[model samples]
Target: MTAQQPAGGAAIPQRPAVDFGRRYITFETPRFAGRTPRRTMIVCAALALVILGAGLASLTLGAYEVSFGAVIRAIFDPASDPDARQVVFEWRLPRVLFAVLCGAALALSGGIFQSLTRNPLGSPDIIGFGVGAQFGVTLVMIVLELNTYLWKASGALVGGLLTALLVYALASKGGTSAFRLIIVGIGVSAGLGALTSWILITVSVEKAMMAATWGAGSIASLGFDQLAPAALVFAVILVLTLPLTRRLPVLEMGDDAAAALGIDAGRTRFAAVVLGVALIALVTAAAGPISFIALAAPQISQRLTRSNSPMGTLPVMLTGAALVVVSDAVAQLATVPVGVVTVSVGGIYLAWLLAAQYARRA
Candidate 1:
């Protein structure tokens, strides 16, 4: 085709306008101009206070009604009072610690996925990985006849990894749209949820009851031995995840931009997904699929820090820990599962989020 001639008699070339629909949206790590470090310090300190207050409430407000000083004394000097030590150190302490650890893990996992997918709804629990892990645990307990903590953990890890791989593959086939990924993940989660229920129903009555209880997501009746391995795994994963997540805000700028910044967007995403899945699996294996903490914690942290980016990892972790500890304490009032409380609270928050989004659009 011949080029068109303009009024000046020179040939003019026409080019199509570039579309910036998805790639235009970019989020960077939260930064401050002058008082960055100070603000961060204050936020961190505030988050710590929240976590500490939750822990104190968990330790003090229970059936025994131990005082805060008594709880502290029992933790540091268990030999001073046998009854106090028994209540704080032996009975309640392990459960409380597990709740905190699991909550942190779930929140971190959620943060990683949300950053990777660049969607607020990209959470392990929401995307079916949590249910997948629960299915694995159920299978091990009922079908495989292995009820050990290690076996359950292995099952959960395998299940979660498989689900992640499946979801990523399906999403990438169409070039990895975040909305598509979430839709696919929801379908996968529904299937897995059905399977979990089927497994529960087919098992013997006692076994079914046991599976149901665990599936309800409780930190109750746990011992130090159960929490120890999970804690070690969480610490190792945290060490690995923290460094990798330094690239997350960059990744949020789209693959091309991220590559321009010398970040291997693909590799970083894979590592993040792996680490996030591992976190979810470990926590699910340790304390079942505690619902909504993963879905809610990152958003809460983001709002609390008033940052647009998902780089507030520590804040998210602390918020998550505080949430679960507080929820567990509330659950203690009715002696119900912490998962129940989280789901109820999360449902209300989810409703609010939807309403806010609609209002903004309007």
Candidate 2:
């Protein structure tokens, strides 16, 4: 599984010795470590093309029903048909791109969290990272009465990071056990969510309504400018993340083993939490904490591709894109909020997760 050995490769991260006996743990490094399975690569490529197709479809299809030709023309010759260009590129393209960006961000974040925690259920919404982001938004909307986009986003990032650290600190007493971490996270998230609810209830009715709608998530009128900064935030985090991927497989080898293998578990875990929280917080800030895209994306990606050390980051991104694009389409047609659609779907996935766990235990 070793790639061409570099001079300091082993020095950088001592090649971890991992052996899988008879039993299967999902988090085990693939037998084909350091090399992606050819089939999964092919599937990932197919999913990317499908995502591109969906993006084009989103641009072309709507109430006005622009032709593919017109959409193409509108994209290329903006001055020729200003109205159509506004509809196609300015309006629809941004939304489609938003879905892509949000999807990829959530999925990657979910994968990172799941990898770090070794818990499939470790997404922001369930584990309280999303709650933190929501708390941040609440502060801006309720206390400050200033929902300027960047301020709210800043709130989200701050809140999410703080909450994640608190959760980790509380859970680390007994050695950062995944089960304890998740349980503590659930408690923290519940408390924060209740606090958010209390604030909204106590506030003026108009503000409450606005908060509620935003909380439920809407892309109806979000322009490109509104979504751009969030994209930039995700991009910056992603650049920092690429170097960390190789470290993840080693960190999965338990804290003691990780230390033995020269992988700094504490630092690695911190990096994962920060990245995960930032990703979700930015999306929440931009899109109002939309539903289960973060939760569902990683799980679906893991199941679809069998080699799951958590998951290939790309598949999770693709799965997220598909989930949001599909969920957004449903939201548009059914008069449902994007967040609501995602929750309903996510609830189903959560149920399935519980059932599968029980079955495995039995």
Candidate 3:
């Protein structure tokens, strides 16, 4: 293309047209290079603010009723009121932080599976992984009589990975079909759930009650003792999974295409399943299986950012954190488990998603 001549007989340079639809901010460096949509960045910022607001509300609105100013002072100033310090720091702060971490972990796990299966319903909760983890914890507490955090975490991780393998084996007859995977997952989830129920009934009432309460998923009794170790494990798993996040999107292009691009499809899927199960196990060990945050957060983030693909891990994590913190605050007011609140909300979201999917098909 030639530059246009103006009345002055001089050529005027023409600038390339910018795509106003989805503006992206690109970065390149020796160590790393990537681009993110401006909308996604804004959405992430807003979600972060939501988490902050919800966390503050959780700290202030408990039965103890610490004022906002006192909450701030208790966190920052050592000389703050003793009662306020204990209430905010010892009682509430740990729970709030745990909620954030647990929510982010579950959401990340959900995003990994959803992207791998290339389906909206491909979450750990839907696919029996969460139930498998829960069953593991129950076995450790009830059958094996090993109720330590380490044993329960190990059980949950192993159970979740085994469930994932079973589902994959059942679904991969000719090739792994997304619809077949969901169906197989639902079946596996049902079987594990029934086994969990049988285990609960066979145990002593006190043990059963304790396991049941934990199974309902409450962050209420957790404090620094539980939070410290969980936080460390979460940090390690997150760092290990960071590189795999970029590879997952490539696998969505199909095994052959991914291989053509020098990506190992089978290895990526295996690693994602292991790491994703590890994430579920982390949360289940700390809090029992806190339901539905995993199922809802990634899809919600996708819709908010107007993205076709659910590869926006950061935004999904932020959305999950906000959901969990807010839900826990509500649960406190209702004197119920946070899991109950999440299930209620997530059920509604799941129904809507199904209806939307059916509508599109029709």
Candidate 4:
């Protein structure tokens, strides 16, 4: 590769193309430039298709038994079977859309933390953030007796941020390391779990039951009332997160190296933690603490794309959305909470991941 002489008679520096045995497409502009693996693009496309197919499949699974055609018509045709339209639009569509939003939000949060910690196990669910959010929402519902979306969202956001700060403070004792963070987080999560349990036991049976159901994490009862606000918050948090995507990978190179590159490691990490917690809070507020999608989605996407970079946010979110949509559909068939389905599947994934990590160490 060589610099090309332009019409102005000046040599325009060109980035030399390097082949690394894998095909990649490059793009450049005055404001931005990057290369993407072909495999990543394909995997992302496939995941998007999976989310679409699974979401459509989910729409037809309930007791009302809307046919595939009916589902499509309900969405597009105003005059198509008023009853079917009601079932799909008013009832089922919200749940399906919520599933996608929650899944994507969780996955993005997980990716942010994992990238920050540079460890596969660094997820909001594992770090007690989800538990903290659950605890907050529990207090609001059981003690404050406020069940509105705003109250729950506020509780979740505050609780998750507090928990994240505690974990970070504990882990940062001698400068935070991935292993220390995970260990401290696990301890915090366990203590919170015990406290939540104690609170449940002391509360009235009705309140306890309601808390337990929400804690188990189900989207069955959620409709537009919750979805609209959640979606709005998600959009805002996502915009804040976009700038971090590029900076996060730089921080992965370590604080000194990132500093040399003009990236503020401390500020970036703080923003990542806050935005990540907000993402978790958003999901926990509406759907309760749906677990494991955050833990598994990013890793699954990384493996599917075979990319080392944690910047592949879109594919990770799609993977999560697909996972939740499919799992929700399965939950409908079993008449169980979506959280139960994810926990069952995610537990297996966790086991496999731990085994792999152990084997590598051994």
Provide backbone clash counts, one per model. 0, 0, 0, 0
Error of 3 at 44 (Å): 1.2
Query: Which scores greater on TM-score, model 1 or model 4?
Result: 4
Worst 10 residues of 1 by lDDT: 20-29
Report lDDT (Cα) of residue 199, candidate 1.
78
User: Over all chains combined, what TM-score does candidate 1 have?
Assistant: 0.87
Tens-digit lDDT string for candidate 4 (167-282): 99999999879999999999999999998999999989999999999999999999998888889889999898999888998898899999999998889989999999999989
Off by over 4 Å in 3: 1-15, 18-20, 26-34
Candidate 3 per-residue lDDT, tens place, 1-362, comes to 45898988889888878766998989999999999898999999999999999999899977787999999999899998999999998999999999999999999999998998899999999989999999889888899889888999999999999899899999999887989999999999999999999888887999999999998999998999999999999999989888777788888888888899899887888889999999999999989989999889999998999977676778988988999999999998899999999999999999999999999999
lDDT of candidate 1 over 252-306, digit per residue (tens): 8888988998998778988898899899888888788898888889998888777
Task: State TM-scores per candidate.
Answer: 0.87, 0.86, 0.94, 0.93
Give the per-residue Cα lDDT of candidate 2 at 210.
Answer: 90
Model 2 stretches with alpha carbons more than 4 Å out: 1-35, 76-80
Off by over 4 Å in 1: 1-36, 76-79
lDDT of 2 by residue, 165-228 (tens): 8888898895868889889999999999999999998999999999998988877668778877
> Model 4 off-target regions past 4 Å?
1-17, 26-35
Give candidates' CA RMSD values in order: 9.7, 8.0, 2.8, 3.7
> How high is the CA lDDT of each candidate model?
0.84, 0.81, 0.91, 0.91
